[model samples]
Target chain A: MNTFMGYERPNGDIGIRNHLLIIPTVICSNQVCSRIMQLVPGTVAIPHQHGCSQIGADKERTFEVLAGTGKNPNVGGVIVISLGCEVVDPYALADDIRKTGKPVEVFDIQSVGGSVKAIKHGTELARRMLEELERQPKVPIPLSRLKVAVKCGGSDATSGLASNPALGAAADALIAAGGTVVIGETTEIIGAEHVLAQRCATPDTAERLYHIVGRFEREVERMGADMRGGNPSPGNIEGGLSTIEEKSLGCISKCGKAPIKGVIEYAERLPEGGLYFMDSPGNDIECVSGMAAGGVHIVCFTTGRGTPTGAAVVPVIKITGNKRMYDRMEDNMDVDVSAMLEGAMSLESAGERIWQEILEIADGKWTKSETLGHQEFSINRIGPSL
Target chain B: MKQQIADGVDALIMDNRDHVATVLREIMSGDTVRYRDDHGIREITAIDLIPFGHKIAIEVLDTGDDVCKYGEIIGRACFAILVGQHVHVHNIEGIRGRGDRAGKAGT
Candidate 1:
């Protein structure tokens, strides 16, 4: 059996990484949380501008992403810090993460006194968690247990021509090996949704796919704005993507040819062992963050124009079909498949190269994004904060 | 067997059903570019100075015809286009995400 060394969590999930995550329950707690992460080595922090003034589904989304990040199999333990008066229930969030059978602790900055005192308290707690996390043993786990997310950003024509399709081939290989793959960026799938809808495992799945796309379109319509104004962004247009449809056609190719098992909401816990599609925004950091919150162990991000985005908890492997961009942004890119266009490399070979990179990363090799300290995290918000 | 030309391949046609091909390298006007697809190697003369990664019409298209690439309709030709002409925002209009252009044939 093909296997990679991973941290086997008590919940029976295999984690390619063992991280001590520091989470801020509200925007007010960001400074304290950041201070703790800065004070403690081997700890990661996700500080977002949310958790307060959000109502209904929006509030639930913030809570879900926060709790989900803590519950990710990659996290050995979590320390949630909150402002005592925030709308989000920090204790409830901690309880949710604790259900994963991992150690979870929560504290409030106001309750601990203030910034200075809270920073000290959080740092001590984070240090203890990191020490415990460092003691966790790594065990060999079947590669079939891994869940990977596929995404593309800063895309150009070469993304469609080479990298995305090569990534697709790799995605297919992982699925065939019994792993799970999730693809997102609903807006990016606008033109090519019909193609994806056809790949749904069931008629209901197909209908849900169309429904989410339609809902996103109607939401954009409600704002009396054109999605084209934001999508096929200026950089995308300069990179030779003429329309949203052209961009979508290329974007959808990264998930490979597997039948989409299901369509899921953003930050929703993914089902096991197949290809799934998550409805998400096309923004680079936000999309990757959602996948991280959805419990993906790694993200394969294809870029043509180049971007340096990574997730707070997930390792991002940046692949680019633009050799020029890769050369220019070598510090940010992980794999360069541009040779496929030159005929020096074949698509299948490129896919194999990426698959090997995935296995190596899963086995504890650091990616460019991870080494560069690009732990970017953001939540997609649906409504304005009060 | 057909001879496989290794050099001077400046563009790629992803599918036989595609109406457009993407230029892999910059091509000056009047330059002959060779592209390969499943059908085999074919050549077209560039009518415009096509930049790298941009599309060139592989088939002539009338106004309002769907422009296909990757064997899928990507957009609609906004005006008459001849083979080898650059196909982009100037001649091809996106059929999706444009609130004003909704309900088009491809949408």
Candidate 2:
């Protein structure tokens, strides 16, 4: 079938999961939000460390990510909680989300008297929002409205050889079906960006692609450190990735052979269908979080060393190429393409298997990460605290 | 197709022009490591112990030469590397995105 079950949003976007997301606008509101989530059923809360004492780009990122997560079509309603005196404006955040035409309610901890009172007030708000969301009927969403992010973490050599190529094939299939595909982790694009540049659909995209890469490299250089200090991270080196280029070459394969239509900044909303690249950190949680905030409905993650990471607002499907790691971390992994390395399975067959899994997930099948409750969230911050 | 394990094509050369092959299994010194690429299945002897998933040099590389994998330059060789030797962080250095070595290795 070319369509999946989803809820129609008033903003004209289709959401596969009708999540009532509890957003903490600042660190002081996290405990209250968490309490409300526990007190009310069918609620998810995102607890973050920033939103206080942050200045300039750092503070702006926290606001943009929080607001974008609230605007994500996957979320049907939102409850924004604040600490009253943080740098990020809670009411402003609520206003940003309201622009999406979704139901959003905002309140601050200081005005509500304290944590206990705040939790009580937030729980009541959540329960009512969730009830309203439950009344929304599920409708069919075409593949054209679906956007999936391709990410890789804890990569080993086999990632480049097996699972990534398999995922690349699946990515191509998704785009062929009129779906949108996004690939991020600009940190992984260091050496082989030339290959991506050559595949850009326009000169503008190629320039933007080069601009982001060059900017990241200059920043890393300004810090007086090498990308090697953290990249091809110890786990990656142990798993057989020797250099940034080798790791990046493997990393890029998961996005397939589609021409990049655009290169967007972190947390920026995506354009309509075809392939796009988001300039995001290579850190797993940060990259996935950025993509989720950018309106991706699902994340197709490839790992070689294995990770249990998921996203707070979107479903993350874990695909691996290491047979031993998959067997060891079977509970965390959903698809295993290691047979391609053994020559037991063709690349196309392995890719088809992943493609089928993506379809099933879009139809409401829970991913291993979702089933295991791996809702990991992180925001990429530039600049520093005041 | 099912003869992979028994046939001893235990390693892979992702591209035919790559200078190294990734061993699918641990290889003891002097063991014949078999691999397949565009040229089909080929064999080389490991002169040093290579761990599983690590690289085994398929070509001789001198210091300052590019270490090729996936048919692209992964790093620059800091030390001499012989055919069948282990190629890793100890012998190869990443040449991009560093400020300490700025103005060197452009492109």
Candidate 3:
């Protein structure tokens, strides 16, 4: 069994990278979080327009996503800053993260006097947390302890042909090694759900799979519209896809042929082993963010077109099978499996290549997105902002 | 080998269901073709104007007939479909189950 060297967290999770995360409880505190992250070297803060004016499930979703992100194994420690009057409580958020056994500190701008005062207090706590995190050491961890999330964006014809299938092979390889793999984008799976259901371990799991698809359809129906008009984007059509089912059939290929053990909600903790499904929207950034918050240490994103998106903590490995697009966006991409289409490479060969890349990345080799400083972050909002 | 059509676009082969060949390209009228009793791809000589990503109705399909593509039934044809034509929003519709609630309404 292969293994990689990584930092062993006090909470029993192995982390590929030790990241110091700065979180804001409200959109109002984003500036402060950004300021602190800038002032303190090696600290990363997520800036987003959420955490306020949300009601019911929407507000809870924000809170859960925030806490889950902070608690992700990749994060060594966290510094949570709040506006004091937001819907999400800063102290509670800090407590939730502290459960991970990492260093956690919280401060409210209103309670700490103001921006200047809050920054001052935040700087002190951030410095302390960073110092403590720096004290942690790396340990040898099995590859099976690692979880990778598979995603795709800006898809094209070559996606299903070269990139996604290659990703599927890689996903199967990881699962064979006893490592966990997760695939999401429920909207993209619309046409191929039945095929996936057939691969479910049992009848109940199959039923559960159908339930997820039904839920999304009903939700769309509630919006008083039909998906017949749109699901495959203009880009998908231009790239040669005609319907949602057509696009979905190709999209579902990334999951490979592993038995789906369970289906989980967005940003929820994944199952122990094998392939799992996370319920996430098709928006690239939001889906990736949800996976990160769900505790995935790395993301394996396959694209036929291209996107430059990275998470604050986890490393994102961008793979593509479109030779032209790969060359066009070499800076943003890491693995190019286009040779599979050209017949120079086999699917298993491509999968082996990706698995090697995963090992190197886990050992601290920065992905193209990370080196380019593409730390794009966004949370999917459930309802309209008021 | 078990071959299933993920859709009308990609053809997938596994070990379980090897009886039928899935559709790799869309078929149209005036096109000649041969496939399993389920479905087959025909060459478009006259090009009867089929949508690129949509499925083509290869043979007579009953209401409960499993719509085959990539060697597997992606869905059940909601209505009867004619042979050698297009199959998509016009004929096939999805049936979702309960657990698919993580993303937005549509793909």
Candidate 4:
């Protein structure tokens, strides 16, 4: 239990996987990145629709998220693809990830000749990086080296009782082992923000928690609608939730009972350890993408109703507490804690089960998401697409 | 502690001393239900028809008194409430300094 095998980076970051990633800094370079991924068997690429015409925080958020994703411990090396001039600076992003001591290569479509030349160049660089990554061997690392993001999507009544709390217990275990655990979805904290604030380790942390909640609320209101009517999602309502507050209260359980160490902005690199909160939207894909982009090595996602969502790089471990849903979506699920309701399993036992699954996943086992090829990626957008 | 019940179809945290429990089955006026306090489950008859997961006022609470759930006040009753009536947004108002969601708890 003390150590799980992982690939160690030169910067001292331990990676669960030694994946060589091809990151496209702009939408224009997505095809090139994807082509590179297709050519290189072990390489992964995330094609997002942002990085152009975005200004201020939105543009900065893109750069930070993309850089963080590349720097995630799961990636042993990275190759960044860019269009030479975009809102996000590819060199700066490369520099940011290079600090992790991993091999980083940057190529621009305009700088490297043209589209045909860029694709060829990007593929060659990706192939070299993949070969270099393949040379690195995994070593046994302490459990404390792990950092996990806890999430829930497609929730139902059973989510609170089963999967969320079960994941929370696993989160608590990770924190106890001196590892870092982060929980996000600021919008889901709406009606329940106060309760979480009280658990903050410091007054400032508590204030920041509320500040993020307020900002999301005000921003949503500016769009001329309330969050309650829409926050639950049509599926959530049909599953039995009534209001945003109702949904928020249940969503908070995935974090477990750890002290809220701090609140961070969306896509920001997580401060090393303990439980931190990432300010993010509740939209499942965006939420998972933000966590993946923020350097989370893996994500423990809970659901009552199911979703087949995954990330382009980070492995998403799907956990469900609903027995029926688990049975129906067995192909999509990784772990099931539904036995707790039947008195066949203790909550702690269920948590330990999930923790074991996480360890196995971190050790390079493919999750149901990965096996099924569910690499769904999307960036939360702001401003107009110009 | 007198126990308040979370009514309606959604799950809820009723008392700060008691864990928020989901409503598995619906109840009607005069139907007897059991609620747990610090000691154990106490049986009480519904004063009015109550849906699943919606809260029922357990003790006399004034406006702004923190409504407890998951063993903490999730929000405050927006208005006064009798001992055995439904507690929800219609009656429960948010205390709102830094509490987690308003009514739902134990998630």
Candidate 5:
């Protein structure tokens, strides 16, 4: 099909799901916001251990993630819950989310009396907002309007051999159809940055690509720690990956052959209609969260060893190339391209399978991650907490 | 025309320029393994037992030589590597990602 049913946002973006999101501005407000989510069915809540005791960039990162999560097209309405004395400003946070033209309501525990009263007040607001969100109509939107993030984690040999390249083919197909695709994981791109740099659309983009990898390497040095200590984690080694270079060569294949449009900071908004790179950590949950905050509609996560991490505001479609892992983790995996390894299916055919899954997901089909309630969220931090 | 090798394909070569191919399954020493890529199918005898997913050198490499895979340099050979030998961290050092060796050759 040329189009899928989606909620058209007032900011001219298309969202596959219309969700009422309950956002807690700090760890102190998590219980109350989660209580509201439990009270109101169909409402989603992101409870993170940040927004308090965080200084400078760390504090700003928390605010950005909360605001970005609320501004995400998938969230039709938002409730910003604050502890009243946290570092994050609730009114400003609500106003930031309002830039998307979505309905945002802000409240605080101290101002609303106590936990019991706050929960009651938040529940009432959430119930009304959920009812309003449910009334939002799904209109037919062109598939090209979709923005997808490409990520791989728990990678093994099959990840590089089958799933990654297959996803790359799908990424290429989507880009060819005029859709936007994003690839991240700055740490994972170290050994293979040259290959990606050569594919950059401009000389400046190529230089920036190198700059980020160099910067990440220097940061790892500042800690007097070897990146190899953490990278190619024991799990990766057990799964047959020998070195970070081998793993990286495989990791970079998931973005397909599209020219790199530009490099963006973590959680930065993505440009429309091309392949872009977001500088993010290789940590699965944080990378996926960054993409969701950057306004991606979906994330196609490829794995061989397997993981069940999903995003709070975007659907994550898990694809694997190991038949055994797929069978072993059937509940977590969505598409199995292991047939390609056995020569039963060609790469193009395997990619077509993932592409079809993407279309189905875009048409409102729930991914295994979403159905299993995997709304894992984490913000990649660059600074220390106060 | 590119020839297609019969079954028993135990490894996969991603490109013609690759110095190594990935073992798809456990391969014992002396086993004549088959591999295929865009260029065509080829066979090589395993000199050492290679574990699944680990790479095996497809071509000989002298010390300090760059090991190419996926048609790009993934690492550098720290010592001589012969065809059919297991290619890994023991013999090849990563050219990137290590801060101490950022601009240095074969660690």
Candidate 6:
């Protein structure tokens, strides 16, 4: 129980998966990268629509997410494909990932002649990488090396009453074993930020938590709009969540009662143990993407209405507390704790169900989203694209 | 305690101080449901039709009073809430992050 199986990288990082990742440096090269992935069986490709006409932190984010994805321990090697005329430099991207000591190959469409030629060239490189990746062995890794991200979406009344608290218990269990846990969704924590601030491990950490919440609020106020309808989304109200405060009180319980060790910016790497809060949005795909880019190995997402999102790199384990949604969307759900509502299960046992599933996934169990090929990826944009 | 309900309890009063109990099943107006709080097992009558996962006021709440759940203030009552009345957005108004109430004190 103290160790889970993973592939150890040269940089001293452990990888639960050994994948050959194809990264497109710009939207123009996405097609070539997709073609390469189609031609190579065991490779994964991320075809995002950014990387051109970006400036400032906006441009930096795209590059950082790509580099971080490449550097991710889950990826054994990377093939950086560019259009040769984009703002992001393909060589620089490769160099950033090289710091992780993983094998990386870079090329641009202009230098390779065209999309057709680029796809052909990338396929050749990917085939070799896939062969090398297939040979990697998964060894037992200590639990202290594991980092998990706790997230929730499509929330309803049951989310607060059951799933979030259950996930919180499971998160506490992992932290007790010396693993790290991160909770995100800054927008969702609006009405309950003070409650979280009080649980921060230090005054500095508490200030950072308030600073992020205050900064986000100021931006909204400056725009002359309220976060009401958007945050409690129509779905949230229909599911019986009455107000932002009520929804938030329920939302904060998913991270358990662990003291907040630190507060990190969106896509910022997490520190070693306890619960760290990430200042990320409530959007499911964007939140999961930031956590993966921040180097989390897995995500435990709790929902009442059900969502079928999986990360391009890490496995997403979906948990639900609504019996109706679980039965209706059984294909998308990985764990169910609805028995709590029916008075058939205890809270500790509900959390234990999710805890056991996490250990199983760390040892290479494919989540429902992964089995369905739901490798959803997205990067949250902070500023307008130039 | 996450409010450990002994087996067979039909509803939950999450905290001893909460004025509302979330119904676990649909109940018609005037139906009685059993719930447990730190006060021990008790029964409350529904003054309005309540759906599963929706809260029922177990204590009378006057307008502008802080509505509590999980032992914390979730919002303020916008109207008088009678015991057993279904509590929801129609009755409670959140006091935080309101752009519409900007610059107003004690709204």
By DockQ, who's the top model here? 6
CAPRI quality band, candidate 1: acceptable
Residues A240-290 of candidate 1 have per-residue lDDT tens digits of 888888899999989999999999899999888999999999999888888
For each candidate, what is the lDDT?
A: 0.89, 0.89, 0.76, 0.77, 0.88, 0.88
Please report, as a residue range, the 10-residue window in candidate 5 chain A with the lowest summed lDDT.
A220-229
Scored by Cα lDDT, where does model 2 land? Answer: 0.89
lDDT digits (tens) for residues B27-106 of candidate 6: 79978878986567898788788888888898999999999998888889999999889999899887766776666676
Candidates 5 and 6 compared by TM-score, better number: 6
- Give DockQ for candidates 1 onward, in order: 0.47, 0.55, 0.13, 0.11, 0.42, 0.57
Better of 2 and 3 by DockQ: 2
TM-score of chain A of each: 0.99, 0.98, 0.97, 0.96, 0.99, 0.98
Q: Which stretches of candidate 3 lie over 4 Å from their true place?
A: A228-230, A384-386, B1-68, B72-107
User: What's the CA error at residue A45 for candidate 5, in Å?
Assistant: 1.0
RMSD of each: 2.3, 2.1, 5.6, 5.5, 2.4, 1.6
Model 4 ranges with Cα > 4 A deviation: B1-21, B25-107
TM-score of chain A of 6: 0.98
Distance (Å) between predicted and true CA of B26, model 1? 0.9
Pairs in clash, predicted candidate 1: none
Q: Is the docking of candidate 6 incorrect, acceptable, medium or high quality?
A: medium
Which of candidates 3 and 5 is the stronger one according to lDDT? 5
Question: Between 1 and 5, whose TM-score is larger?
Answer: 1
Kindly list the per-residue Cα lDDT of model 5 for residues A1-386, writing each as its tens digit: 88999998888878999989999999999999889888988999999888888888788887888888888888899999999999999999999989889999999999999999999999999888888888888899998999999999999889988899899999998999899999999999988888999999999999999999989888876665456648888788777776677889899889999999999988888999999999999999998998899999999999998899888989999999999889899999999999888878788888999999999999999999999988999988877777
Score residue A95 of candidate 1 by CA lDDT.
94
Q: Which scores higher on lDDT, 2 or 6?
A: 2
